[model samples]
Target: MNLYQKLVEIRKDVINFSKDTESFGYKYVSGSQAIAKIREKMDDLGVLLVPEVKNTISSTYDYINAKGKECTDHIVSGEMSYKWINSDNPEETLIVPWQLYGAQDDISKAFGSGLTYSERYFILKFFQAPTDVDDPDSRDTSNRGKGNKKGLSEAQVKRGYALGFKAGYDKANVDKQILSKFNKKIQDLTKEEYEIVCNGYEKRGGK
Candidate 1:
C-alpha cells in the first residue's frame, strides 16, 4: 500500500462511498483506530475506536499506514465482508473502497456552511440496519434484535394508536410524542371507530 492509502472513510455511512451507489458492503470500520481503542475499555460494550501504542499524527506516513492495517483485526466489530470487485475476475487486487458517511440527517438538512456539517453527530446506520452475523449471505432476512427506525413509519403510527386505545393513558404514555400526533379520540375510539380510522388511513395512502 502507498503512503496515500486511506484505510477508513471520515464519514459514517460506508455504502455511500461510491461514484454512484457503491456495490461493495464493508462493516466494522473504526472511523479512526485511535477512537476505537479508547472505546474498547467499555468491556463488551462494543466501541469503535481505541489507542494502540499512541497513534500520533506526527509520525511518518509509513508508520500511520502500517498502524492502520496492523490494527485492522483489533477493531471491535471484528468482521467485515465485501465480494470480489469483479465477479468475473476474482484475481483483481482486492478492490474495497473504504468510505464513511457522517450522519443521515446532517447530509439532508446541512446548510451551505461547512461548520454546521462538521458539528453534526457520527453514527453507524445500515440501510436495513443488519445486526445478525451468523448468516453467510449478506442479506439480513432475520431480525432478532433492533431499535426502532429513527424516523416514524406507517406501522409505527398504527401501533401507537393501537396501544393507546388498549391501555388508555398508560399506553398513550408509552411514547408521548407519537401519542400527541394521534387524534384526541384515539384512546376512546372503539373497534368500529378504530376500523373507520384505519379505513381513512388506507384511503389516504398509509403505508
Candidate 2:
C-alpha cells in the first residue's frame, strides 16, 4: 500500500477517545498514551514519521502565583515540520507543519511540555482520531461541554475567567481584552497563551 492507504489503516486502527490523563479537574488523553498507540500501528504498517524543529524562541518572566508566592515562568515558542514516509517506498513522502507554545517554571520543562503537546496534537489531528464527543461546532450544547474547536478545555476556560476576574476585569472585559491583545477569543487561546495572560493578571493582583 502507498502512504495514503497505510495512513488510512492506521487511522482505522487507532483509539478514538481516551480519558487516561487528568488535569485541572478533567480527564483527557496523555501524549504518551497517544504516541504508544500510534507507534505500534506505524511499525506494523511499515510507515515512518520524522519530525524537525524549524525554529524556536525562548524567554522568561517573573510573576506571583494565585497563592501569593513569587514565581518565574520559562516560555518557548516553536515551529515544527513532520515528514511522513512509506518505508516500503521511501521516495514518497508528505510534509506536515505545526506550531507550539509551552510555559513552565523550569526551562527544560517548558520545552518538554511544548514538544509533548506538539507531537500529541500532530498525530491525533493528522489521523483525524475521533474523540467520542459531539462535534465542537454542533449547536447541540450537550456533548459540547468537553472540548471546543479551539482546543481549550472547559476547566481551562473556567480558570482563565476566574483569574481575569480576580485581576479586576469582569468576564466581558476579560474577553474583550484577550481579543484585543492576543487576536484570539478567550475560548480560543492556547494553554500557554492563556497562561501568559493569567500570569500577567497575577502580577497585577500582586501589585
> Which ten residues in a row are the worst by lDDT in model 2?
134-143
* Candidate 1 wrongly placed segments (more than 4 Å): 1-157, 160-184
Q: Output the TM-score of candidate 2.
A: 0.64
Model 2 lDDT tens row, 53-156 = 86666665454444679877666655678999999999999998776556777889988887887888787777776643532221222224444355464435
Model 1 residue 183 CA deviation in Å? 9.3
Candidate lDDT (C-alpha), each: 0.27, 0.70
**Which stretches of candidate 2 lie above 4 Å from their native place?**
132-207
Evaluated against the true structure, the overall lDDT of model 1 is 0.27
User: Model 1 compared with the native: what TM-score?
Assistant: 0.15
The pairs that clash in candidate 2 are none
> Per-candidate TM vs. native?
0.15, 0.64
For residues 40-113, write the lDDT of model 1, one tens digit per residue: 33223222221112110110001112125521111000112222222233243232222111111232221212
